[model samples]
Target: MNILHLSAVNNWGGGENQIELLCREFKEHYPEVKNQILCKKGKLFHKRLEKTNLKFLTASLAFQMDPRYIRRIISICKKENIDLIHIHDSTALSLAIIADNLADLPPMVFSKKTSFPIRNRKQSLYKYNHPKLKKIFCVSKKTRNVTSEGIQDENKLVTLYHGIDPELQRNLKPGLDLRNFLKIPSERKIIGNIANHIEAKDLQTLVKTANQLINRENRKDFHFVQIGGFEKPRTSSLLQEVKQFGLEEHFSFLGFRENAAALIPQFDISIITSESEGLPQFIYESFFHKIPVISTGVGGISEIITHKINGLLAQAHDHKKLCENILILAENEELIPKFAEISHQMVLQNFTSEIMMEKTLIEYKKILHERL
Candidate 1:
């Protein structure tokens, strides 16, 4: 099937990474599926996609709606003879909807990557109150609930957990030299947070939780290493917040690392303190590396970290519970293996790129069958 996968960004965040990985898998596993990606020109992901059958088209969008860009996208879709439009974010979805109308289009699907409340209630209503959308491929149930609440096409929403290339992840096994690169001691117990410094990610909660551990005279050896970037304007306050808390000495903000999976093994524990998320791809990466995670219960996080099984979960925004979980993981070594085993099994069984691609193909075929 001919397809156009759309995304506005080319940066290295969870959503961007997810799109890149999906494109890569589509190219590798489904060669018959001719696909192109519509994106802003000259971005990192746009450049990276040069290596695939997925052709790249440039279309600038303002937030989730821009008429001029949508017109351009529609013209391109018609010229390319596209059969499916799969959007990775809202901005792309806006353009896709316009293109669909113009080209007498095929099926359209949006990959639900985040729980939608972050978009103000008014904006959410304006953007999602559509019936033409064929399906929503939610990466988690939490994301599905949020989208279903705002969208009229409840039956079209399908919960499909995000997936990664198990082989690629397995090849990048965790090791100790990552600590050496960070100038951290080989023996210091490390707690890592791999999230962009955004309000939705709750970096403040992560830092506060770290401080709570630091305040404990008994747990001074625990270190906090944050692995993400602040390229976006919304996250400008995080650097100042880190300084305000006097966490400069104990906290390591490594910006964005391309080889994050390689570094996962160096840290003794991983944490996700997001205010919202879909099923975070990092959770699967952590399990792939056999590193246990302690995350706040939000979005579809609970779908992966099944409390006391794969990893620990605390209530969202609750720094005390975060502190408690971190300390418990730090103190008890036996609990680590149990969590790792369960998580590894869970990811291998349910969340591999192979499974995701198969399901996505099925969805595409189903949509086409309905049109026929």
Candidate 2:
């Protein structure tokens, strides 16, 4: 089957990672399944695709409503004879909505990777409820629940958790030991967060949590190391907050590293302070590396974190609760490896790339058959 996967997002985040994984496995599982990726040129996503053999087209999105951009997508779809178009971001979906009105487009499926609710508006309705969009694959049940409420056809929405290949980042020797590079004392414990400086990531609560940890006499030794790139304005604001909280020494912001995955082994524990997520990619990667995850219980996170079972959960934006969870895991050293094992086994059994690709192919086939 011919499939066209499209993502207009310039940054390479969890959704892009999932798309790349899907493309890689699509090639391996069905060599005959023709796949194409259309993404922005000179972006992180394009850089990741340079080594892959998957067919891809690159373009820049000056504006979302640009008819030229829509034409570019339609032209590629026509040339590739794409049977179906899988949209990964809202920008692509929006353009597809406009493009569909101007041309006879192929069936489209959108992957809703975030748990944010869709606005009940004409624009949201056109992008989601349009006739061309055949399916809405949500990364978490929470995302599906929130998204289905705004849409007319609840049957079009499906929960498909994001998965990872356990061995994908194995054997890559990172040139930099993050702890050593950061000049953090060898004996101090490290709490690592791998997310960009976005509002949804909720770094404000993370800063507050760090302050709370420092206030605890025994928890002062723990260092929170985050590796993410952000715009200067956001960075400045975050730095200002850290200074205000007197957490300058306790918090370390290691701006965007391409090989951030390689540094997970250095962390004592992995934490995600996001207010919303469609089951974050970092959690799966951290679990694969045998690092126990502590995250805010929001969106699809509850589905993956079984409350003190595989991993621990804190209420979103509740830094006090987050600090409490952190102390529980750190103080009880025995629970670290135990939690890691449970999470690792969980991902291996249910959230692996192999399982994701298999299920996706089944969906693709089922959709095509129904259309026929």
Candidate 3:
């Protein structure tokens, strides 16, 4: 079967990682199943695709309804004999739906990776519940639940947790020394977060909590490191927030480090304060490194953290509780290893790339068999 994967996002993030991981695994295990990607030209995904052998086509899509891009998809579908279309992001989903309308295309599936509820209003609803969309692969149960509100056919939504390559991160050597470079003292406890600067990440809460911990509590023993690229046009806003909150001494923004995963082991504790999420890739990577997580109990995070069992959790936007949880993890040395051990084993058992690829292939076969 020939599958055409579509992604329109310019930034490289978890969704892009999912595409690369899935396609690579699928190719290795199922060489008979041909896969191709249609991505935005000159974008991060397109650049990364060059590193892989997977066939890809790119266009500078002006918007979701760009007629030229629709025609391009139609052309690719005919040339590649694409049997299935897997839409990976919002713009790509919209483009695929439009392309389907323009031509009698193959069955399409959409991957829902965000836990933010789709606005149940008419147009947004149509985008999600379009007739051409055969299935919606959700990364988390919370994402499925939120998407179900905008979807009429409940059976279409399937919760398939995003899986990481267990072997890829295992035995990863420390690629870089972030601590010494930043001039942070060895005695200072390091708290780390890996997320692209986005609204849903709610990094303001992290800054507020840092302010409370550093300034209000007079806890100068902790250093925070955030590693990710800034969202376009919103880069300096975060710095402004840090300045206003008086967290400059405590917080360090490491912009778009290529070896961010390698440095996770250097952190004393890992944290996430996302207002909304499907399931973050950092948590899984941290699991492989045996780094304890302290995240806001949002999205499918609870499914992993288990509130002080495997890792600690706090409510989103609640700076007080986030601070409390961070301190508890920082101060309790015995609890760290226990939490890290359980979390690490959880990912190894349930969330490996092999398991995810095999299960997803089964679903694809089921859908294609029914269609054929």
Write the number of the candidate with greater lDDT, choosing between 1 and 3.
3
For each candidate in the order shown, give its overall lDDT on alpha carbons.
0.77, 0.86, 0.86
lDDT of 1: 0.77
- Which window of 10 residues has the lowest lDDT sum in candidate 3? 167-176
What is the C-alpha lDDT profile of model 3 across 320-361, one tens digit per residue?
888898888767889988998998889989988878788888
* Deviation (Å) of 133 in candidate 3: 1.1
lDDT string for model 1 (149-249, tens) is 77765888898877878888768745446567677765678898888666778888887887777764446677788888665564556667667877666
C-alpha TM-score for every candidate:
0.91, 0.97, 0.96
Residue 118, model 1, lDDT: 31
Candidate 2 residue 129 Cα shift, in angstroms, is 0.8
Per-residue accuracy of model 2 over 122-231 as CA lDDT, tens digit each:
88876788887889999999999999888999999988888987767687566787677777887779999999888899988888889888875447778999888786
Which residue pairs does candidate 1 place in steric collision?
A: none
Model 2: clashing residue pairs?
none
